[model samples]
Target: MFSDSTITENETRRDLPAHLEQLLRTICFRIRVQGREALKNYSITAAQFDLLQRVYFNGPQTMTKLSQSLGIAKSTTSGLVTRLVRDGFLDRRRDETDRRVFTVAITPLGEQVIKSVIEMRVRYVEEVIKQIPEEKITLVHNALDILYEVMSPKQH
Candidate 1:
Protein backbone atom coordinates (compact mmCIF):
# COMPACT_ATOMS: atom_id res chain seq x y z
CA MET A 1 0.00 0.00 0.00
CA PHE A 2 1.40 3.41 -1.03
CA SER A 3 1.36 6.37 1.36
CA ASP A 4 -0.02 9.78 0.31
CA SER A 5 3.48 11.26 -0.19
CA THR A 6 4.54 8.23 -2.22
CA ILE A 7 1.48 8.51 -4.47
CA THR A 8 2.13 12.25 -4.99
CA GLU A 9 5.76 11.64 -5.94
CA ASN A 10 4.72 8.97 -8.46
CA GLU A 11 2.14 11.29 -9.95
CA THR A 12 4.72 14.05 -10.37
CA ARG A 13 7.13 11.63 -12.02
CA ARG A 14 4.44 10.55 -14.47
CA ASP A 15 3.75 14.15 -15.48
CA LEU A 16 7.39 15.15 -15.79
CA PRO A 17 7.83 13.84 -19.34
CA ALA A 18 4.88 15.85 -20.66
CA HIS A 19 6.07 18.99 -18.92
CA LEU A 20 9.58 18.57 -20.29
CA GLU A 21 8.31 18.02 -23.85
CA GLN A 22 6.18 21.15 -23.76
CA LEU A 23 9.04 23.21 -22.32
CA LEU A 24 11.48 22.03 -24.98
CA ARG A 25 9.01 22.60 -27.82
CA THR A 26 8.26 26.13 -26.64
CA ILE A 27 11.94 27.00 -26.28
CA CYS A 28 12.81 25.69 -29.74
CA PHE A 29 9.90 27.56 -31.34
CA ARG A 30 10.93 30.82 -29.72
CA ILE A 31 14.56 30.48 -30.78
CA ARG A 32 13.61 29.62 -34.35
CA VAL A 33 11.34 32.68 -34.51
CA GLN A 34 14.22 34.87 -33.35
CA GLY A 35 16.54 33.32 -35.91
CA ARG A 36 13.98 33.79 -38.70
CA GLU A 37 13.77 37.49 -37.93
CA ALA A 38 17.54 37.78 -38.12
CA LEU A 39 17.60 35.96 -41.45
CA LYS A 40 15.19 38.40 -43.05
CA ASN A 41 17.80 41.16 -43.33
CA TYR A 42 19.98 38.82 -45.42
CA SER A 43 17.03 37.85 -47.66
CA ILE A 44 17.77 34.20 -46.96
CA THR A 45 15.23 31.64 -45.92
CA ALA A 46 15.76 29.53 -42.84
CA ALA A 47 16.52 26.48 -45.00
CA GLN A 48 19.16 28.41 -46.89
CA PHE A 49 20.64 29.65 -43.65
CA ASP A 50 20.78 26.08 -42.39
CA LEU A 51 22.69 24.95 -45.46
CA LEU A 52 25.15 27.82 -45.14
CA GLN A 53 25.62 27.12 -41.45
CA ARG A 54 26.44 23.46 -42.15
CA VAL A 55 29.17 24.41 -44.61
CA TYR A 56 30.37 27.22 -42.39
CA PHE A 57 30.88 24.82 -39.50
CA ASN A 58 31.95 21.64 -41.32
CA GLY A 59 33.99 23.15 -44.13
CA PRO A 60 33.18 22.55 -47.80
CA GLN A 61 31.24 19.45 -48.80
CA THR A 62 30.03 17.73 -51.93
CA MET A 63 26.36 17.89 -52.92
CA THR A 64 25.81 14.34 -51.69
CA LYS A 65 27.46 15.01 -48.38
CA LEU A 66 25.58 18.26 -47.85
CA SER A 67 22.30 16.56 -48.59
CA GLN A 68 23.11 13.82 -46.10
CA SER A 69 24.06 16.33 -43.43
CA LEU A 70 20.97 18.41 -44.02
CA GLY A 71 18.78 15.31 -44.22
CA ILE A 72 17.29 16.48 -47.46
CA ALA A 73 17.18 14.89 -50.90
CA LYS A 74 20.17 15.44 -53.19
CA SER A 75 18.00 17.16 -55.77
CA THR A 76 16.66 19.58 -53.18
CA THR A 77 20.17 20.30 -51.94
CA SER A 78 21.29 20.97 -55.50
CA GLY A 79 18.58 23.56 -55.97
CA LEU A 80 19.62 25.34 -52.77
CA VAL A 81 23.24 25.31 -53.86
CA THR A 82 22.32 26.75 -57.22
CA ARG A 83 20.43 29.66 -55.66
CA LEU A 84 23.14 30.36 -53.11
CA VAL A 85 25.73 30.32 -55.89
CA ARG A 86 23.65 32.73 -57.95
CA ASP A 87 23.27 35.04 -54.92
CA GLY A 88 27.07 34.93 -54.33
CA PHE A 89 26.62 33.48 -50.88
CA LEU A 90 28.22 30.15 -51.79
CA ASP A 91 30.86 29.12 -54.26
CA ARG A 92 30.73 25.79 -56.07
CA ARG A 93 33.71 24.25 -57.75
CA ARG A 94 34.24 20.91 -59.40
CA ASP A 95 36.64 18.62 -57.59
CA GLU A 96 40.13 18.76 -59.16
CA THR A 97 40.59 15.02 -59.12
CA ASP A 98 37.03 13.74 -59.40
CA ARG A 99 36.03 16.25 -62.11
CA ARG A 100 32.37 15.24 -61.80
CA VAL A 101 31.70 16.05 -58.15
CA PHE A 102 31.24 19.61 -56.95
CA THR A 103 31.98 21.03 -53.53
CA VAL A 104 30.20 24.00 -52.00
CA ALA A 105 31.88 26.52 -49.72
CA ILE A 106 30.47 29.53 -47.95
CA THR A 107 31.66 32.85 -49.36
CA PRO A 108 32.75 35.81 -47.21
CA LEU A 109 29.28 37.31 -47.55
CA GLY A 110 27.75 34.10 -46.24
CA GLU A 111 30.10 34.14 -43.28
CA GLN A 112 29.11 37.71 -42.50
CA VAL A 113 25.45 36.81 -42.54
CA ILE A 114 26.10 33.92 -40.18
CA LYS A 115 28.09 36.13 -37.82
CA SER A 116 25.40 38.79 -37.77
CA VAL A 117 22.69 36.24 -37.09
CA ILE A 118 24.72 34.74 -34.25
CA GLU A 119 25.28 38.17 -32.72
CA MET A 120 21.58 38.83 -32.84
CA ARG A 121 20.86 35.53 -31.10
CA VAL A 122 23.50 36.26 -28.46
CA ARG A 123 21.93 39.64 -27.72
CA TYR A 124 18.51 38.04 -27.38
CA VAL A 125 19.85 35.46 -24.94
CA GLU A 126 21.66 38.16 -23.00
CA GLU A 127 18.40 40.08 -22.60
CA VAL A 128 16.78 36.99 -21.13
CA ILE A 129 19.75 36.33 -18.84
CA LYS A 130 19.58 39.89 -17.57
CA GLN A 131 16.07 39.31 -16.29
CA ILE A 132 17.05 36.47 -13.97
CA PRO A 133 17.91 37.40 -10.40
CA GLU A 134 21.61 37.51 -9.53
CA GLU A 135 21.33 34.84 -6.87
CA LYS A 136 19.51 32.39 -9.15
CA ILE A 137 21.85 32.89 -12.13
CA THR A 138 24.29 30.23 -10.95
CA LEU A 139 21.46 27.80 -10.40
CA VAL A 140 20.09 28.49 -13.87
CA HIS A 141 23.53 28.10 -15.43
CA ASN A 142 24.16 24.81 -13.67
CA ALA A 143 20.76 23.50 -14.65
CA LEU A 144 21.38 24.35 -18.31
CA ASP A 145 24.78 22.67 -18.18
CA ILE A 146 23.30 19.50 -16.77
CA LEU A 147 20.47 19.52 -19.32
CA TYR A 148 22.91 20.01 -22.19
CA GLU A 149 25.09 17.17 -20.97
CA VAL A 150 22.15 14.83 -20.70
CA MET A 151 20.53 15.80 -24.01
CA SER A 152 23.70 15.93 -26.13
CA PRO A 153 24.35 13.03 -28.45
CA LYS A 154 26.90 10.60 -27.04
CA GLN A 155 30.11 9.92 -28.92
CA HIS A 156 31.09 6.40 -29.78
Candidate 2:
Protein backbone atom coordinates (compact mmCIF):
# COMPACT_ATOMS: atom_id res chain seq x y z
CA MET A 1 0.00 0.00 0.00
CA PHE A 2 2.80 2.41 0.84
CA SER A 3 4.47 1.53 -2.46
CA ASP A 4 1.42 2.89 -4.27
CA SER A 5 1.79 6.32 -2.75
CA THR A 6 3.75 8.94 -4.72
CA ILE A 7 5.42 11.69 -2.73
CA THR A 8 6.10 15.02 -4.45
CA GLU A 9 8.07 18.06 -3.31
CA ASN A 10 5.04 20.40 -3.26
CA GLU A 11 2.50 18.05 -1.73
CA THR A 12 -1.12 19.06 -1.26
CA ARG A 13 -4.04 17.32 0.49
CA ARG A 14 -5.14 16.20 -2.95
CA ASP A 15 -1.84 14.35 -3.38
CA LEU A 16 -2.61 12.23 -0.32
CA PRO A 17 -5.28 13.39 2.07
CA ALA A 18 -4.82 12.44 5.74
CA HIS A 19 -8.54 12.32 6.49
CA LEU A 20 -9.20 10.00 3.56
CA GLU A 21 -6.29 7.76 4.55
CA GLN A 22 -7.48 7.66 8.17
CA LEU A 23 -11.02 6.79 7.17
CA LEU A 24 -9.82 4.03 4.85
CA ARG A 25 -7.46 2.70 7.52
CA THR A 26 -10.23 2.60 10.14
CA ILE A 27 -12.60 0.81 7.79
CA CYS A 28 -9.91 -1.68 6.82
CA PHE A 29 -9.06 -2.34 10.47
CA ARG A 30 -12.67 -2.99 11.38
CA ILE A 31 -13.21 -5.20 8.36
CA ARG A 32 -10.03 -7.14 9.14
CA VAL A 33 -11.17 -7.70 12.71
CA GLN A 34 -14.53 -8.90 11.49
CA GLY A 35 -12.83 -11.06 8.89
CA ARG A 36 -10.66 -12.67 11.56
CA GLU A 37 -13.75 -13.54 13.60
CA ALA A 38 -15.43 -14.99 10.54
CA LEU A 39 -12.31 -16.93 9.57
CA LYS A 40 -11.90 -18.33 13.08
CA ASN A 41 -15.04 -20.40 12.56
CA TYR A 42 -13.22 -22.04 9.62
CA SER A 43 -9.86 -22.29 11.38
CA ILE A 44 -8.22 -20.17 8.71
CA THR A 45 -5.49 -17.64 9.47
CA ALA A 46 -5.12 -14.34 7.62
CA ALA A 47 -1.94 -15.48 5.89
CA GLN A 48 -3.52 -18.72 4.75
CA PHE A 49 -6.58 -16.91 3.52
CA ASP A 50 -4.42 -14.49 1.58
CA LEU A 51 -2.43 -17.28 -0.05
CA LEU A 52 -5.60 -19.17 -0.87
CA GLN A 53 -7.17 -16.12 -2.47
CA ARG A 54 -4.08 -15.43 -4.57
CA VAL A 55 -3.85 -19.00 -5.84
CA TYR A 56 -7.59 -19.16 -6.39
CA PHE A 57 -7.80 -15.96 -8.39
CA ASN A 58 -4.51 -16.18 -10.26
CA GLY A 59 -3.88 -19.88 -10.74
CA PRO A 60 -1.08 -21.96 -9.27
CA GLN A 61 2.30 -20.36 -8.62
CA THR A 62 5.77 -21.68 -7.94
CA MET A 63 7.19 -21.26 -4.44
CA THR A 64 9.49 -18.50 -5.66
CA LYS A 65 6.70 -16.76 -7.54
CA LEU A 66 4.31 -16.88 -4.62
CA SER A 67 6.95 -15.60 -2.25
CA GLN A 68 7.86 -12.73 -4.55
CA SER A 69 4.26 -11.84 -5.21
CA LEU A 70 3.49 -11.80 -1.51
CA GLY A 71 6.63 -9.78 -0.65
CA ILE A 72 7.51 -12.33 2.03
CA ALA A 73 10.58 -14.44 2.55
CA LYS A 74 10.56 -17.81 0.79
CA SER A 75 11.23 -19.70 4.00
CA THR A 76 8.12 -18.24 5.58
CA THR A 77 5.96 -19.01 2.59
CA SER A 78 7.45 -22.47 2.45
CA GLY A 79 6.44 -23.25 6.01
CA LEU A 80 2.99 -21.80 5.46
CA VAL A 81 2.57 -23.85 2.32
CA THR A 82 3.82 -26.92 4.13
CA ARG A 83 1.14 -26.50 6.75
CA LEU A 84 -1.54 -25.92 4.17
CA VAL A 85 -0.41 -29.03 2.35
CA ARG A 86 -0.51 -31.03 5.56
CA ASP A 87 -3.93 -29.66 6.43
CA GLY A 88 -5.24 -30.73 2.99
CA PHE A 89 -5.91 -27.19 1.88
CA LEU A 90 -3.11 -27.14 -0.70
CA ASP A 91 -1.24 -29.52 -2.99
CA ARG A 92 2.49 -29.13 -3.51
CA ARG A 93 3.66 -30.84 -6.66
CA ARG A 94 7.17 -31.23 -7.98
CA ASP A 95 7.74 -30.42 -11.62
CA GLU A 96 8.21 -33.46 -13.84
CA THR A 97 11.21 -32.04 -15.64
CA ASP A 98 12.63 -30.24 -12.66
CA ARG A 99 12.16 -32.25 -9.51
CA ARG A 100 13.58 -29.51 -7.32
CA VAL A 101 10.98 -27.00 -8.52
CA PHE A 102 7.52 -27.23 -7.03
CA THR A 103 4.23 -25.47 -7.58
CA VAL A 104 1.48 -24.90 -5.05
CA ALA A 105 -2.21 -25.06 -5.76
CA ILE A 106 -5.38 -24.80 -3.71
CA THR A 107 -7.26 -28.01 -2.98
CA PRO A 108 -11.03 -28.46 -3.14
CA LEU A 109 -11.23 -27.98 0.61
CA GLY A 110 -9.44 -24.66 0.24
CA GLU A 111 -12.03 -23.46 -2.25
CA GLN A 112 -14.77 -24.43 0.17
CA VAL A 113 -12.99 -22.58 2.94
CA ILE A 114 -12.75 -19.45 0.82
CA LYS A 115 -16.39 -19.75 -0.21
CA SER A 116 -17.57 -20.19 3.35
CA VAL A 117 -15.48 -17.24 4.48
CA ILE A 118 -16.97 -15.01 1.76
CA GLU A 119 -20.49 -16.06 2.75
CA MET A 120 -19.73 -15.23 6.34
CA ARG A 121 -18.40 -11.82 5.34
CA VAL A 122 -21.47 -11.05 3.24
CA ARG A 123 -23.81 -11.87 6.09
CA TYR A 124 -21.71 -9.86 8.52
CA VAL A 125 -21.71 -6.83 6.22
CA GLU A 126 -25.42 -7.18 5.58
CA GLU A 127 -26.10 -7.10 9.29
CA VAL A 128 -23.94 -4.02 9.78
CA ILE A 129 -25.42 -2.17 6.81
CA LYS A 130 -28.92 -2.82 8.15
CA GLN A 131 -28.11 -0.58 11.13
CA ILE A 132 -26.88 2.31 8.97
CA PRO A 133 -29.26 4.96 7.60
CA GLU A 134 -30.50 3.87 4.15
CA GLU A 135 -29.36 7.03 2.45
CA LYS A 136 -25.93 7.01 4.00
CA ILE A 137 -25.58 3.33 3.16
CA THR A 138 -26.22 4.03 -0.52
CA LEU A 139 -23.70 6.84 -0.42
CA VAL A 140 -20.99 4.54 0.89
CA HIS A 141 -21.85 1.91 -1.69
CA ASN A 142 -21.61 4.47 -4.50
CA ALA A 143 -18.36 5.78 -3.09
CA LEU A 144 -16.88 2.31 -3.20
CA ASP A 145 -18.03 1.92 -6.81
CA ILE A 146 -16.35 5.16 -7.77
CA LEU A 147 -13.21 4.33 -5.82
CA TYR A 148 -12.91 0.97 -7.57
CA GLU A 149 -13.23 2.62 -10.96
CA VAL A 150 -10.57 5.18 -10.11
CA MET A 151 -8.21 2.54 -8.75
CA SER A 152 -8.67 -0.05 -11.48
CA PRO A 153 -5.93 -0.41 -14.08
CA LYS A 154 -6.74 1.04 -17.51
CA GLN A 155 -6.49 -1.04 -20.63
CA HIS A 156 -3.45 -0.63 -22.86
Candidate 3:
Protein backbone atom coordinates (compact mmCIF):
# COMPACT_ATOMS: atom_id res chain seq x y z
CA MET A 1 0.00 0.00 0.00
CA PHE A 2 1.30 3.51 -0.87
CA SER A 3 1.93 6.10 1.86
CA ASP A 4 -0.05 9.39 1.95
CA SER A 5 2.88 11.43 0.55
CA THR A 6 3.38 9.02 -2.35
CA ILE A 7 -0.32 9.18 -3.24
CA THR A 8 -0.20 12.98 -3.26
CA GLU A 9 2.89 12.94 -5.45
CA ASN A 10 1.28 10.53 -7.89
CA GLU A 11 -1.81 12.73 -8.12
CA THR A 12 0.32 15.82 -8.79
CA ARG A 13 2.16 14.04 -11.58
CA ARG A 14 -1.12 13.03 -13.19
CA ASP A 15 -2.37 16.62 -12.95
CA LEU A 16 0.75 18.18 -14.45
CA PRO A 17 -0.42 17.72 -18.04
CA ALA A 18 -3.63 19.63 -17.42
CA HIS A 19 -1.76 22.45 -15.66
CA LEU A 20 0.72 22.68 -18.56
CA GLU A 21 -2.06 22.70 -21.17
CA GLN A 22 -3.82 25.56 -19.40
CA LEU A 23 -0.63 27.56 -19.16
CA LEU A 24 0.08 27.16 -22.87
CA ARG A 25 -3.45 28.10 -23.84
CA THR A 26 -3.42 31.17 -21.63
CA ILE A 27 -0.11 32.32 -23.05
CA CYS A 28 -1.25 31.88 -26.65
CA PHE A 29 -4.53 33.66 -26.00
CA ARG A 30 -2.82 36.65 -24.46
CA ILE A 31 -0.30 36.93 -27.27
CA ARG A 32 -3.00 36.67 -29.93
CA VAL A 33 -5.01 39.39 -28.22
CA GLN A 34 -1.95 41.62 -28.14
CA GLY A 35 -1.35 40.97 -31.83
CA ARG A 36 -4.92 41.98 -32.62
CA GLU A 37 -4.35 45.25 -30.78
CA ALA A 38 -1.23 45.81 -32.92
CA LEU A 39 -3.20 45.13 -36.10
CA LYS A 40 -5.62 47.91 -35.26
CA ASN A 41 -2.88 50.49 -35.84
CA TYR A 42 -2.32 49.18 -39.36
CA SER A 43 -6.05 49.26 -40.23
CA ILE A 44 -5.91 45.55 -41.03
CA THR A 45 -7.97 42.65 -39.73
CA ALA A 46 -6.34 39.63 -38.12
CA ALA A 47 -7.28 37.37 -41.03
CA GLN A 48 -5.83 39.80 -43.55
CA PHE A 49 -2.65 40.14 -41.54
CA ASP A 50 -2.33 36.36 -41.41
CA LEU A 51 -2.67 36.11 -45.19
CA LEU A 52 -0.09 38.80 -45.80
CA GLN A 53 2.31 37.29 -43.27
CA ARG A 54 2.03 33.92 -44.99
CA VAL A 55 2.82 35.41 -48.41
CA TYR A 56 5.61 37.55 -47.02
CA PHE A 57 7.31 34.53 -45.49
CA ASN A 58 6.54 31.91 -48.14
CA GLY A 59 7.03 34.06 -51.23
CA PRO A 60 4.42 34.17 -54.02
CA GLN A 61 1.72 31.52 -54.04
CA THR A 62 -1.24 30.55 -56.19
CA MET A 63 -4.81 31.13 -55.06
CA THR A 64 -5.36 27.42 -54.46
CA LYS A 65 -2.23 27.20 -52.34
CA LEU A 66 -3.23 30.24 -50.30
CA SER A 67 -6.68 28.81 -49.76
CA GLN A 68 -5.16 25.57 -48.55
CA SER A 69 -2.65 27.25 -46.31
CA LEU A 70 -5.23 29.55 -44.77
CA GLY A 71 -7.75 26.72 -44.48
CA ILE A 72 -10.39 28.93 -46.03
CA ALA A 73 -12.67 28.47 -48.98
CA LYS A 74 -11.43 29.47 -52.44
CA SER A 75 -14.09 32.16 -52.66
CA THR A 76 -13.05 33.57 -49.30
CA THR A 77 -9.41 33.63 -50.34
CA SER A 78 -10.38 35.35 -53.60
CA GLY A 79 -12.20 38.10 -51.72
CA LEU A 80 -9.22 38.62 -49.40
CA VAL A 81 -6.77 38.74 -52.31
CA THR A 82 -8.99 41.16 -54.19
CA ARG A 83 -9.24 43.54 -51.23
CA LEU A 84 -5.52 43.34 -50.47
CA VAL A 85 -4.65 43.92 -54.11
CA ARG A 86 -6.99 46.88 -54.29
CA ASP A 87 -5.33 48.30 -51.19
CA GLY A 88 -1.91 47.92 -52.92
CA PHE A 89 -0.70 45.51 -50.22
CA LEU A 90 -0.59 42.55 -52.58
CA ASP A 91 0.17 42.15 -56.30
CA ARG A 92 -1.57 39.49 -58.34
CA ARG A 93 -0.11 38.39 -61.65
CA ARG A 94 -1.34 36.02 -64.28
CA ASP A 95 0.97 33.17 -65.19
CA GLU A 96 2.65 33.54 -68.60
CA THR A 97 2.56 29.83 -69.46
CA ASP A 98 -0.84 29.26 -67.89
CA ARG A 99 -3.01 32.29 -68.43
CA ARG A 100 -5.69 30.85 -66.19
CA VAL A 101 -3.38 30.60 -63.22
CA PHE A 102 -2.59 33.56 -60.97
CA THR A 103 -0.03 34.12 -58.24
CA VAL A 104 -0.23 36.42 -55.26
CA ALA A 105 2.77 38.16 -53.76
CA ILE A 106 3.12 40.65 -50.94
CA THR A 107 3.95 44.23 -51.94
CA PRO A 108 6.53 46.41 -50.21
CA LEU A 109 3.70 48.08 -48.32
CA GLY A 110 2.56 44.67 -47.06
CA GLU A 111 6.08 43.88 -45.91
CA GLN A 112 6.22 47.13 -43.99
CA VAL A 113 2.95 46.37 -42.22
CA ILE A 114 4.16 42.87 -41.30
CA LYS A 115 7.42 44.21 -39.91
CA SER A 116 5.64 46.84 -37.87
CA VAL A 117 3.21 44.31 -36.41
CA ILE A 118 6.03 41.98 -35.49
CA GLU A 119 7.93 44.80 -33.82
CA MET A 120 4.90 45.69 -31.78
CA ARG A 121 4.38 42.09 -30.70
CA VAL A 122 8.04 41.70 -29.82
CA ARG A 123 7.92 44.87 -27.74
CA TYR A 124 4.96 43.54 -25.82
CA VAL A 125 6.81 40.31 -25.10
CA GLU A 126 9.89 42.25 -24.05
CA GLU A 127 7.91 44.30 -21.59
CA VAL A 128 6.37 41.16 -20.09
CA ILE A 129 9.72 39.41 -19.81
CA LYS A 130 11.20 42.43 -18.04
CA GLN A 131 9.09 41.61 -14.99
CA ILE A 132 10.85 38.29 -14.54
CA PRO A 133 14.13 38.08 -12.60
CA GLU A 134 17.37 37.73 -14.60
CA GLU A 135 18.24 34.29 -13.29
CA LYS A 136 14.73 32.90 -13.82
CA ILE A 137 14.74 34.29 -17.36
CA THR A 138 17.47 31.87 -18.37
CA LEU A 139 15.60 28.96 -16.87
CA VAL A 140 12.38 30.02 -18.64
CA HIS A 141 14.24 30.44 -21.91
CA ASN A 142 15.85 27.01 -21.61
CA ALA A 143 12.52 25.39 -20.76
CA LEU A 144 10.83 27.03 -23.78
CA ASP A 145 13.68 25.92 -26.07
CA ILE A 146 13.31 22.35 -24.92
CA LEU A 147 9.53 22.49 -25.32
CA TYR A 148 9.87 23.84 -28.85
CA GLU A 149 12.53 21.33 -29.80
CA VAL A 150 10.41 18.46 -28.63
CA MET A 151 7.21 19.74 -30.25
CA SER A 152 8.80 20.70 -33.58
CA PRO A 153 8.32 18.41 -36.54
CA LYS A 154 11.17 15.99 -37.26
CA GLN A 155 12.93 16.36 -40.60
CA HIS A 156 12.97 13.21 -42.67
**Number of backbone-clashing residue pairs for each candidate, in the order shown:** 0, 0, 0
Candidate 1, residue 71: CA error in Å? 2.6
Clashes of 1: 0
Q: Each prediction's Cα lDDT score? A: 0.88, 0.83, 0.88
| Number of the predicted model whose TM-score against the real structure is largest | 3
Report the C-alpha lDDT of model 3 over 7-119, residue by residue, as the tens digit. Answer: 67679899999999999999988876776676676667778888999999999989999999999999999998899999889999997788899999999999888887778
Q: Give candidate 1 regions above 4 Å deviation.
A: 1-7, 153-156
| Per-candidate TM-score against the hidden true structure | 0.86, 0.79, 0.87
Can you rank all candidates by TM-score, best first?
3, 1, 2
In angstroms, the error of model 1 at 3 is 19
Q: Considering lDDT, which of the candidate structures 2 and 3 is the better prediction for this target?
A: 3
Report the C-alpha lDDT of model 1 over 64-91, residue by residue, as the tens digit. 9999989999999999889999998999
Write candidate 2's Cα lDDT for 1-156 as tens digits: 344356454565465678688889987777666656667766667898888888888888899999999999999999889888999889999877788999898999988887876776677788889999988998989999999999999988
For model 3, name the residue pairs that clash: none
